[model samples]
Structure formats: C-alpha cells, structure tokens
Target chain A: MVRVAAHNIISPLGCTSQENFDKVVAGQSGIALRKKGELSDTDFQAALLNMEVLKDKISGIANAEAYTKLEQLCILSLNEVLDGVDVKSERTGFIFSTTKGNITEITNNPHAVDALLATTANKIANYFGFKSSPQVISNACISGLAAFVIGRRYIDAGKYDNVIILGADILSKFIVSGFQSFQSLSPEPCKPFDANRDGLTLGEGVASVVLSKADNTNKACVEVVSGAISNDANHISGPSRTGEGLYRAITRTVGANEEVDCICAHGTATPYNDDMESHAISRAGYETIPVSGLKGYFGHTLGAAGVIESIISILAMQNNVVIGTKGTVEQGVVAPVNVTKENIQKPVNGLLKLMSGFGGCNAAVYFKKHGE
Target chain B: MVAMLLFILKSMENNQIIKEVSIEHGKVLINQSEFFTGETSDLGPFLKSLYKQLNLKYNKYFKMDHLSKLGFLASEVLLLNEGIANETDEVAIILANASSSLHTDVKYQESIADIPSPSVFVYTLPNIVIGEISIRNKFYGEHMFFVQPSYNKEELLDYTTCLFNSTPCKYAIVGWVEVNRNGDYSAKLMLCQNKK
Candidate 1:
C-alpha cells in the first residue's frame, strides 16, 4: 500500500498543515473580499495570501526574486515537507500538479517559453536533485488528487518507492478573469450546499505530500486504499445533471457497502457542483456520511484544492472530528445528504475525498488511517 | 528487498507497445502509414477539410478550440475505425505535451481587455481535449493530461502500464498532443491493451 508520510500546505490561513488545521478547527476563515481595483476593474471576493508575509517568507530563500510566485510557493511548500528526508535518490520520483504553472508570467506574452508547465516542474525538481525525470500533471481542477493517484500507481507498479507530489496555482488575472467571465465567482463568501449559495470564491495556495510504500515509512501515515476517476461525457464546463461520473468514481473507490466516516468534497459552492456531489453521495448509498466543503474557510484553491483539502481531511481524522461545511445554512440539493454545519466529533477511520473539475472529470480516493 | 527488486524488473518486462499514430506537417500517420495529408500552412482549414473528408457528423467539432480539434481529429482517425470510442469505463486517455493551451490562451488574453469570451476561456485548460473526446464518444472513464518537455515514449509507456496494472482500465489511448506558440501543433496517439 502507498501511504502519505508527510504533508504541508502554504496558504492564506498559515504556512504549515498544523497551522491551517488549528484555524479550521477554530472556524476562523482565511477568506476576505479583495477589491476589484486591486486585481482588476471589478471588485471580487477571494482568499488571497498576504504578499507582505509571502515576501518575508521569500526573503529567506536563495535567489527567490528570480523565481515566479507560483514557483516560489511550490518550492516553499515542498521545502516544508522535505525536512529530514532525502529526495536525491533515483528511487524517488517527482510530480508537479497544476492547471497553469507560471501562467502569471505569461501575462499578455502568450508565446513565452517560460509559460510552459514543464519548465516549472524541471526547475523545482532540479533544485531538489530528483534523480528521476520529473512528471507534471495538468488535468484541470482534479490535478492534485490525480497526481496522488499517479504517485500511488507508480509505486504499486514498482516504478518508484517514494514520490514527492507538489501542487500549486495562483489566482492571476487570467484565471480570475476567466472564471469571472463564466460568472462563477461569488461576490460574497461561498456557502457550499447552502440553498442560497451563488458561486465559489477563488483562493490561491500550494500544497505538497510525500508518498511512500507503507513498509518503507515509519512515520504516522494514511494508507491510500484505492482511487478512481471518471468523466461525465456530458459537458466540458458543466457537470452532469445525473451525477453519473462522480457516482461511478465513488463506487469504484469504496465498494457499495464500505463504510465511510467522512467525505471531503469539492464543494465549489456552485449550484451545479454541490448539487451534483449531494446526488452522487445519495446514489452511492453514502448520504448519511458526514460531508463538508472547506471552500468557506479558504475559498477554492484550484490545482491545490484537492491536495490541500485532502491534507485537511487527514488532519480532521487525526483530531477525531469532522470539520463543518463553512458558510452553509440550509440544504439545497434534491438528494438528502448530511452536510456538517458544526464541528462534530466522529471516528473518521475511513475517509473519502471527492473532486470534480472542468472537462467532466471526477476523482474519488479512499484512505485508511495507518498504524499509530 | 531482493524479491521486491525482482518484481520491479518483472513488471518492466511486461509492458507492451500496441498501435501508434502520429500527426505532423499536415500528414496523419497510423503506424507510419499515411492516412491523411493537407496543406500545413493553415491549421484551421487543414483540420476542417480533414473533418469533412473523414465524414464526421459531430457538429460540436466546429465549436472546439484548435487544441481540442487537434485531439478530436487524431482520435477519430486512430480509434473511430477500431470501435474504441464506444467503450465506457474500460478505456483511458493519457496525453502529454509541452505548450499547454497557448493558442487559446493567447486568444483569451486578446479578448480580456474588452469582454473575455467564455467560449474561448472554457478551452483555456489543456485537458478540455479529453472532455471533447469524452463527450463525442460517451466515454465516462479515467482520462489525464500531462505536461512534458517533449514526447517521451518511456514516460508514456510507464504511466500507461501503471494505469492498466493498478486501475480498472483495460485499454489505454496514450501519446502526445501539443499546440506550440507558432500555432503549429502535432498529435501522436497509441492504443494499447493489457496483453497479460
């Protein structure tokens, strides 16, 4: 079994997983409404990292100014997880997940070679001396969890014993403006699964995880039991109304009868996304499982969403509690689902993470708490 | 440790190369056999003519960006005749490339100053090609898009083998699809199934 040995999340809430977890448990939101004049001509609500603090953090790194903000965030998050571990061995593989890497640098110059995602992956991998060729996964919003599945599959296929998976994407004008064009950005803090929920608030962050064979790691870990991905084959931007893809992915990961203590969902707070997830859970016979969307706490972090949210879910299990779906007041979907509105204590031994992205892609991963 | 090393070596030997398809210089090659040829000068007209000649009826083809159109054309030429598209939950799509959605990115950037086009912006993601193909074929299966410096057959082989070995997927459509800054693009697809 492949297991998560270590993880780190660099976001607006904090720099480390524990810091973000503390804020989550306290119900303190990292989201705030940034004025439109600052990013664009339109005032929008989002969870943005304090650049002053990020600059202070960047000052400690060598030649940080030479790197792009996305690269800096990726390196910073990767550094936090690499402590006391050596990734220079040939057995260690590197995977970078993002929808758009260094895209902020592209700006209006669309032809720049530095805009390539592979360029960012190579720079980061070379910095850490990964002996194996670096791999980059860019499958829309599901990139993070898809990267996890890739890492696990690589290990199971005996390609690598350890893999370092890093995910990062920033809210640049290109990303924000595109979503705004779709009218998917919420003017207020998002309320996932809430009847009044309008749209999602964009967030930016970087998250990393070190996955190794269960027999090779002594650190407290969570075994990645199974993972599956399915497409809606319905629409590129809109999710399937029937939730066919997510339902199949969930059933493929956790058999129909398998007990799930908690569900960490990709509740972008968009009407279609939340409703689609609720229906999928009900169809899969997991409607009663505790479900929560952390978007209210940190907004939707894009490429980093899956990894950051999964790490937070692991933290929730470690604390023996299920984090509430922030900003949600009342249920909205046709199918009944137990959306956690308050921090509830529960034995979250078996946890499931679900994410659906543009391009009709849906991913579900099941993880079991490893030995104490 | 020795036993584990043996297993790794054994799995490496088990990987098999199936069918290969490459599209470049306005020529489509299925296993190096010339399937279609056109003027490489203009991608738009070339692709449109190819779609017409192939007699495809998916009208949504006209609405796709260059990236998705390229992938759609490649898959149609490679798998449409082999009955690969009709299978659901059995086949997987794994593609990789260097320049990700740069063509559409430029187009989207041009429109951002006045009114950003949601139609163009929706294709900003490179993986939308997978979505386009999925929608056309009704393939609700595992699909992934990667960004590599160039087309590396080894990485494709490893990842495809890993998927077939570890996931529920039995067949894989794998290779490279890229649209560079010059608006020049090429797609190479290989259809492989587990032999063991």
Candidate 2:
C-alpha cells in the first residue's frame, strides 16, 4: 500500500450541506407526498433532496459534463478536497467508485463510444495533472466503499502516501427512468426496513475523501482498519434473494484485532432488497449491531453510493455515534437486524459499513481509531 | 543513476520472447487471447463465447460497446497475461485519445433518455470499462480514465508516471482505446514499472 494520511469526510450533514441531513436524522423523512417522474404516493413513500440545493452547495463545479454526471461530481469534489493539498508535488492519485457512471454524457454528444463511460477517473487525473495512476472500483452499491479500500491499500503499499477517493453521480434521466420503470421508486419518503416500507427514493450527490500518508490537520479524520468486497454472483440485477452478498461482505471484513459494534447498510427499502438484506444481516450474526442506511437520508445515489456512504460511515465511526435510519419504523424487512431509529449514543471505537448493487456486487468495510 | 536492472527473458515453450522489458518501445499491443481470437479477462469467457458465437472478429469490435469490449481486450493484452496482480497499489487505468466513446454512449443514453434501462445504464460512464476490469480482475489500484485528443509522449509519460509514482504499484496499465465510425478501434498499452 502507498503511504497515506488519515481520511477526512464532507457530507450533506456536518461537513457542507449537513442541515438537510440533520433534519432527516432528527426523524423527519424527506420523501415527499407529491409525484414526479414515474413514482406515485401509493407505490413508494418518497424521500428526496432538492437538486437546486445540491447544485448551490457544490464547490468548483458547473454541473458540466466532460463525460457524465459522475465525472463532473469527481471534479467538483476533488477541486475542493485537494484545495490545500498538493497532488502535483505529492503525486497524489485518485480511486473512483460508482455503480453507474456518467451514462448521460454520451447522449448530448452524438458519435460517443462505449469507452467514454469507463474513462471518468482518467479525465479527472488528466485534468488535474495528477500523474499517480487513478483506478476505478465498481461493486454494485458498494462501489464507493471499495474505492476507499483501494486508497488505504495504496498507503499500505508504501506508494505516494496520499490518495483521493471520490464517489459521485447525478440522478440522470437514464437511472431514474430505469428504477421508476422497474417500479422501484417510492411515491413517498422511503421507509427502509419498515413494515410499511414501499420502495426507494432516488437522489443525487457527490462525496469525497482525501486519504493521505501523513496526519492531516483536519478534524474530521478516520482510519480505515479493514474491509471486504465480494460478489453473490447468484443474480445479475436482482440481489441474491438469500442476501448472500451481504453475509459475505460482513464475514469477509471482520479482522482479528478489529471489532464492529455498528453497521451501515444499503437499505433502499425496496421490497426485495429489504428482505434480502434482512436475511443477510442475520446470517452475518450481527443481529444486535446498531444499523442505519443513508438511502433513507440521502436517497439512493447509485453510482456514487460506495464512496459517499463510506465517507458517511467514516464520519459516523469517527464521531462515535450512529445516525438513525431516518425514515425507518415498524421493522418491515425482518427482526434481529437492529435498525437504528434514534441517533444512538455509543463509544464507537470500530464500525462496519456495507452496500450491495446490481450484478451481485457487495462490499463491507471496518474502521477503527488511528493512533494519535 | 536510473540505468539498471533490465531482464532478458526467453520463458515460453516457443521461446517466443514471452516477456521483454524496454523503455525504447515503451508501448506494445499484445493479445492475451489466442493469436486470432480477441478474448479478454474482464468480460470473461462469456463475452469471449459471445464473440465467437457471432463469428465476431475485429469487424464488429467497433460496433460493440467500446468501453465494455475494449476494457476486456485492452486489459488482457496490456497486463502481459500476468492478469492484475494482488500486490498492485493505487493502479489507475488512464487512456488518452481523440474522440471519446461518442457513438455507443449516445445510443445508450437515448434508450434511457426519458428513463434509463438498468442493463444499459451500467455501461454509460466513461471509465466504467476500467471499473468493470478492476472489479472483475480485483485491481484496486487507483481507478481513473481520461480522454485526450491524441497521444503525446511527454504529456502521457508525465501524467502516467506521476500517476504510477503517486501510488505504490510498480506497474500500471496505461494506454488509449478509441473507436472510429468505420468500425475500427485500436488500442496501445504499457505495463509501467517505477524506477528504483
């Protein structure tokens, strides 16, 4: 692994646009009762954030598309995250994670090729002039978390010692249409793991982390201890009805010296997804671990999920608290898996985070307090 | 100074110079598949079989999704058949070229213009091919994809080596893959190793 500094996190919560997240964490769900796109109030209770707000709060981004919504988010975040840091001298690198990348960029520009979607990270590295090779990781919803895992490994490898892990995506007509068409979008705020849970609400946002070799002076720092990524491979788009991916991610992530007292999951509240996750969590044997899902709070960021949620998990572990499952109630998915409702108070020396995406991609991460 | 440790290899049954290290050529295109078949690792045997079933040669290579197909083929040839090693640190797949995947991208995007299809939406991103490769090959190095108008050695090396040096990986898959409307797509790769 390359040498690296501690990781820092920024979110719609305390970092930047956190006010919105605070409201959700306070037990107020964002899923509105109105209708747009393909969602109806009867199908899914909806929770969504305002894109105008998302656009307003972002730094150094113009909502432009050099390649896709995902590619732009990376630039906007990197410009800010690396503002004080030097990638040129440090040869800082990037590891990008997204389940779905900038699929929208191709349409506006006719004559596009398939390779364009796969080149998002390359565009950023080339634009910023960072020579350290950049890499991409996609493991369904866990894609972002995998990116962070790679960043840490770079440090462990005695490489440049600094890496930028970025997770981002804009809800394109492409993704929204697909889910809505699939009848996966909730009409109201998404009720994750709730007995009345209908479906998920899709939203857009980009989150970033700069993992460096040296100690960063930033207050919002967390050290990643261990992580695991696995594929259920049972189904393509549909998650293993058995939650096999979730179980493996958890089982694979537990390290001997590390302990996970809490978990953050890909609780999209979709009927099938919720049920599969419930079974998977039980199998992981962490029935009592405090669990939460950002989907209720942030909606599903799709391609940007892994990195965005991993940063959120790092923040939760670093703060020693578990954010509520914002819109959860009644335990719709299953029991045993302790879904957090109220912001729980605890001394979290370690934490676990997990996500599963299409293609049976699943991943888990374990974080612990770094030495001062 | 950096003039050291170049290996002389004659390691295959054919003694066909299976591996050779040189900065002189710096870039070479090797086929991981058999001499004629364009098989690859990322898409696995399924895609290889798919190609074979269609009797697809390089003729349709351009017509297929550029990122998906190029990722499978380029990665195989670029990795020198070693496949992505577990020891790699911060590996990024950086490709430079003139036209990005304009054709395939536009078609996929239009299908989901009103609403995206989940299957087609997966490959919409410019760097997704690399992600697919990294995910399948388990290459957790740095993940990045870039589009340049053309190849420039100094700029390419400056950007590429700095990327290699930024991470711990001694080797990197750096190159360009582009598709022409005439159903022509070509790729060039370098297995970059850092100087001690």
lDDT of 2 by residue, B23-59 (tens): 1111223433233333442333434553464453454
**What 10-residue stretch in candidate 1 chain B is worst by lDDT?**
B1-10
| lDDT value, residue A234 of candidate 2 | 51
Q: Compared to the true structure, candidate 1 yields what TM-score?
A: 0.97
Model 1 preserves the real interface contacts to a fraction of: 0.86
Identify the candidate with maximal DockQ. Answer: 1
Which candidate achieves the best lDDT against the true structure?
1
lDDT of 2 at B176: 61
Residue B9, candidate 2: C-alpha displacement in angstroms: 17
lDDT of 1 by residue, A1-372 (tens): 898889999989999999999999999888987877636678888888877887877877788877888888888899888875668776788989898787766675666767998988888887777888889888889999988888888888777888899988888888888999999988899999999999999998899999887774456678887888899999999998889999989988896556699999899999999999988999988878899899999898888988999999988888889998889998787789999999998778899999999999999999878556
Q: List where candidate 1 sits over 4 angstroms from the true fold.
A: A216-220, B1-15, B85-87
Candidate 2 chain A, run of 10 with poorest lDDT = A1-10
DockQ score of candidate 2? 0.13
Q: Which candidate number maximizes TM-score?
A: 1
